[model samples]
Target: MTPTPDPPATLCEAFQRTVAARPQEPALLALAGTALTWAQYAERVASVAAALRHLGVRRGEPVALMLTNRPEFHVADCAALHLGAVPFSLYNSLPADQIHDLLANTAARLVVTERRFLPVLHAAAAGTSVRYLVTVDQVDQTPEEGVLTLEEAEARAPRPFELAAALDCVGPDDLVTLIHTSGTTGRPKAVEITHRAMLSQLSGSQQVLKVTDQDSHISFLPAAHIADRWGSHYTNLLCGTRLTCLDDITRLSEALALVRPTLFGAVPSVWQRMRTTLEGALAEADPGLRALAEEALATGRRHAPRRWKGVLTQAERKELDGADAVLAELRRRVGLDRARVCITGAAPAPEGLQEFFHALGLPLTDAWGMSELSGIALIAPPGMPRPGTVGRPVPGAEIRIADDGELLVRAPFLMRGYRGESELTARTIDAAGWLHTGDLAAVDAQGDIRIIDRKKDLIINTGGQNMAPARIEGVLRESTPLIAHAVVIGDGRPYNVALLVPDREAVTAWARRTGIATAAPWDTHGAELAAAFAGAVADANARLSRAERIRVHEVIADEWAPGGPELTVTLKVRRAAVTGRYADLVETLYRRGAADR
Candidate 1:
């Protein structure tokens, strides 16, 4: 008979083991000018655990966190896990109605939030299951009923609370967190993640990245997202790496220069902004400098290793060395000079953007995963990423194409199920334990997964030809710096049309250079601007198939953003919402026999 393997350890147990071994190591650096060693952080976790216990938080109970990407978020998350409580993360920007809905759904006992969000929480938690409102920041107003500050909680809790026995009670099967989906289609569903799944994901990340204690990271993404929680927070805890928490995401470009992290992860939108900034800077540079930078990038690309299998020849190395100054300056500008590995995920990035980063000596590799996976399942190997492909599956993850062309994954890190949605969960995960990913994917000969598009987002034209709108949108955005966002519309239609959102800054700069008087981006809608957009559409059309080519396009003046009806918190465009809002504009493109622009 085969021997049975030891059961997986709980997240709390794993964290304790690391803390015991590296008590003196720097664990977290807060942007507020405070740093916590492993020992100090563990102490805080214990204290927070005691406070929660005093507050009557029990095993399997949900403790909601509505804070930003701060050290307190990590502390509260770990503290809840220490006592086997489930940590439910809530976006700070969520409206009162959604907050109330989620709170009612989870039946959260306590909500840890800051003062700025107190008004919303106060309204949402009224007559709900919430027993207490734990504020992280102090406020001038008197404490309301059931509201207590973090300091007050700690003061009431007994000192030197023992956590070993409580942690030992936690098992791998215990629910670790309840992460909600982005709800792009409809209401957000809570995904039940387990300790075993999170641990498996951390193990896979460790195997692929080989991160060490010397490596550093900065947390700027929303902590509510699984990619940030599992990929950055939990990974750092398990690896004994230093993590810096950013106070404001708007200052990320400046933070990068200060933190100079060795490992960084961001969505495609952030990468696009960086690329646009760099391009704009280069375009404004002197002719000599521009030429030098271009030559350096070309040389870097020529000498860059493929699949981490090639070595640069001595002559090529020498040529690259000559451009080191320019390369270093460019890298410093983007705050990636020290980045050994930079990853982009959540949404697919343009192939051109990845190639541009590669040419600049920064391998911005593509990663693929969803909230249901607990963490990323597919990440390009360091120094060996293949452009346009979200690399092969990580260890312990099995990926196969379904009969209907959807990607099916059987992974140890898959979520337990959707909380309070048994019917939906059963429909998602089959009897064979395969999680049906709603993405259409194609595996190359090398086993790399190239995602085509979301199965439901596929646009079938009147000619019976299927086209991926995401692919076309990616191409459209990459073709011109002026285009910030693009949505291709042609489902069951005669031809494809596009709704484009222009980059306001880029357009304003162009107008200034061309001596066009414009008060704002919308004011500069002259023949010149029209020609620029038309040129961009033509360029994108040249690369697409005849049937997939965008025949007509219109530019929208208003910018799409989070907190808007047409966008999710992560800034993903809601197709139905956008189409409905601009229904007349879309109809005009197809109805009036508009010229191909």
Candidate 2:
């Protein structure tokens, strides 16, 4: 059973209480062996607060952070909270123009970034409200006019301010942070998170996740993302859980093995890559080992129960234990041997990925939430997760499907409003205080919510039949290992078509084996690649309805990445942007079909 969490009036109170309770316990760990105990972390927060105060940061003012997932992010965020200031988070990889726009929107005066981004920051800060730029790393050249290193600022602090008085000024209703939406459909909007909303989310998650002090977490997601901020940062601070900060996301698998975290949270993309990597490793194992592993997985699936009610019979426990033993090496190899709870959110996961992990005795739970909710509104229970559903509504969050099939949620942790967009916020949040989530979803008989797709992304063909692009995209990607992403396009067309992004490495391997003489797989226009993709598309079409079937597809040469116009910072494809950019290619696919007709 989960213990009732002690509610703190403000974030600072939570941090202070945790530090007082576990002063010697590890609070933060970096990839480079930099560790800080709770007490040490608090001392740094105090120093940072003093520095901010010395720099004239007043209460309620926005202090932006453009740093990566490092210890300083926590320090600076907590420092802002300690000063009763709003911490505005910015993705480090965002283009300079976007950064400038956000800074102007928030009127942020001070931004903390790394030395490597100095030039970009400088350009963005020009003619904006930004007055000071602080670097977390050492600079090679002489400092710019308004630039200062964190170490220099800390050394120059006159004295540590009295935090108790500052804490007294902070209240539950005070604005805590400004988190931006992913902007997959359009421009990013800043969501205003308050102290009360944040604490409410922490309480709700605690009831569901049952996170304890003994559990450790690897913080690898982008720090600016609300999932990382609310799920990882706030949860760790409030629960007194040890958090290991990952510097490089590319080395996440290595970090996972080294940290062996008990609680892990990630976006669906990260989970997908991990799954692909594990499956690749299994396929390359010795034939005997591979056969044994497959048999173990099969047995585990056969014995796995549908739901867990927190109690098990002795025989059932023993059987599960045996299955765990059989697949122990496979779990160790995947670096989830010690994980108790693994969660994926921010985007829809591919079908069967959750079940695959569950067969291995690891419940890869799917969750659903947005920036407006402060944190997750729905989370699949550890052992009782339904494959396609995103579980039930969490405590303090009431969910209902609107008449138009939109999901409406009334949560205690809903954002106060969208910053500088009261009209838009009013439209989004109804007078009854329910947030009208733009997602088209359905509540199953068991009350689990299954998101179909974004309302705007829904495809209505010329035949007036509605289809979900996300469903088709997921099927196409899951049908073959070579396909990385799929964007189904048939909004008002005769038939559905798709733009597919191939997995370059997988394509290269196939090309090598098939004798396709091409230096770059992405650049290759070989018949083998086309045939392989055609086979994959056929597999996907076999499962889809006639109206939803992808009739034709063209594989793109370039991969969609963040910082590109077509992909958001969280890597969600901007459907409109992609279609607009590849208008000619999409037209060609349809034009060929018309010619055939």
Candidate 3:
């Protein structure tokens, strides 16, 4: 059977229809305290679309969007599609040099950015093919004299000209957007998405999530990533649901309270940090407050045992009911009540973290996807969330594990090909339409798939013993309070040693409790550092298997950064990078560096 084609050619048509169906429904909100109805949002999208056409944007041209999580970013994206232009996003966190390289490679005609990012654009525009620089907000000056404010262009351009008819030119095969993966190991590749691909993905997502116009979600993940765009922005567009955008993560808690969103998407790193923050604050809190928080978390853990399988035991269900009442009060205190489903993606979240929230009556759903698949391949359903599994494949998608334990996927949502890299694309997606996911996964008789780890990321010691670091890391994180990332290194060595990055806040509280002289856990405190970190390592080792256990862990003082030998651009730990950087330290650890302790 053929898949359904993408509708809403100009985005104007799709949105206008939605507005007509429910004109008064709120469509968009910002953490900065602004809301727009569907009717109002469509008008803005149309005005922006008209503006882009007036600026000489042609169909098939690539428009680079370099803005943060503001309303204009979404408007600009919809406008690009309206004019049949492909929108490519650049991470705002990137330096101007990286931005220049991307623009030069993609040959983008225009660069859409926020006013605050004008200087960076100007720096990149010193001498480039990029002619028209479009800034969403007011700016004093632009690097390129040809720069046009989005406001100016929209106001000056006449009302959109028969957009519904103009959209007839776009086909399902037309490129809808371009996203550059962080490319932790190599140069970023541009992933091209088509209208049909996006629509198919949204269809699969809707079937699993049951999202509708009544649902509101928070958007903060970089749109430059395919997962963030499809899961947060495009899904909302198709469902006619409202999305709240917040550019600053510092204001996330505040944003949550105000928006009271029903859905939210974030990586494990962000949620792990939140857990660490709450845990640390509780440690230093008043005795009464500390006890209350502990009781609440304990009650939640009992209700929803972190390691339980899909079917809850009778005792578990009963415990959950008793725990739910206590957790309800805790939810009110933590401001997580309105967050009906907190979605985790990009990496496997620690299972304990998932159950902690579930016990508290919040659905922390885990999703799996890759850049090539246009974001999601599988998502845990609300009714059947199996711990440690990424849940079932979304509707219309198929997942099969190869004889060697590699997970392969095939779906309409697969990318057309790696932009301008036909050979690489062919190697990834075969003639039979199966995408070799490069991941190792396991499936039970019931069809739930649990991603063990990346095939290449697995560790094999000299004795021919293989281990999945992700599993060990997950267990270790649950055992300790402050550790954020655990990279087990012992491929050719006798035993595994790890480089652990502590949650700065959690470590600080532990240090203070022991009367340690360290100002911060991330700071170098001389000899005392070895003793403090050793204790944390010992605690973590208690939860690991003999072979998987860390012999000793070195505490780093700095946070991990991409291209800095510790982390990938997506904020995932780079096992190879860590080993390369700390080759000398690994030798010392193997020589029984902390045996005396």
Q: Per-prediction RMSD in angstroms?
A: 2.8, 2.4, 3.5
What tens digits encode model 3's per-residue C-alpha lDDT throughout 386-487?
Answer: 678898889989988999999999998899988899999999998899999889999977778899988988889888888998888887677676677777
207: Cα error in model 2, Å: 0.2
Q: Write the per-residue lDDT of candidate 1 for residues 1-597, one digit (tens) a residue.
A: 999644338778767777887898889897555488889999999898889888989999999999888888899999999888999888877889889999998999899889988899989997789989998878669767889998789889875567687666888899989889855684789999999999998888788888988899998888888888886788877778889999688889888888888998888878888887887788889999999998988877776654144577677778878977898899999999999988998887899888888888887899999889988888888888888999999998999899889999999999999998899999999999999989999999987899999998999988899999999999999898788779899999989889998877678777776677776446535678888899999999999989889888888888886646777777677888888999998899897545542
Model 1 error, position 390 (Å): 0.5
504 Cα displacement, candidate 2 (Å):
3.0
Better of 1 and 3 by TM-score: 1
Better candidate number, 2 or 3, judged by TM-score:
2
In model 3, the Cα lDDT at residue 581 comes to 79
TM-score of predicted structure 1: 0.95
Candidate 2 residues lying further than 4 Å off, grouped into runs, are 1-6, 305-322, 505-520
lDDT of 2 by residue, 75-114 (tens): 9999989888999778877878888899998899999888
What stretches of model 3 exceed 4 Å from their correct place?
1-13, 142-144, 156-159, 284-296, 305-322, 509-520, 525-532, 562-565, 591-597
Ranking by TM-score: 2, 1, 3
Q: Give the Å shift of residue 167 in candidate 1.
A: 3.0
How displaced is residue 139 in candidate 2, in Å? 1.4
Candidate 3 to truth, TM: 0.91
lDDT of residue 118 for candidate 3: 77
* Model 3: pairs clashing at backbone N, Cα or C within 3 Å: none
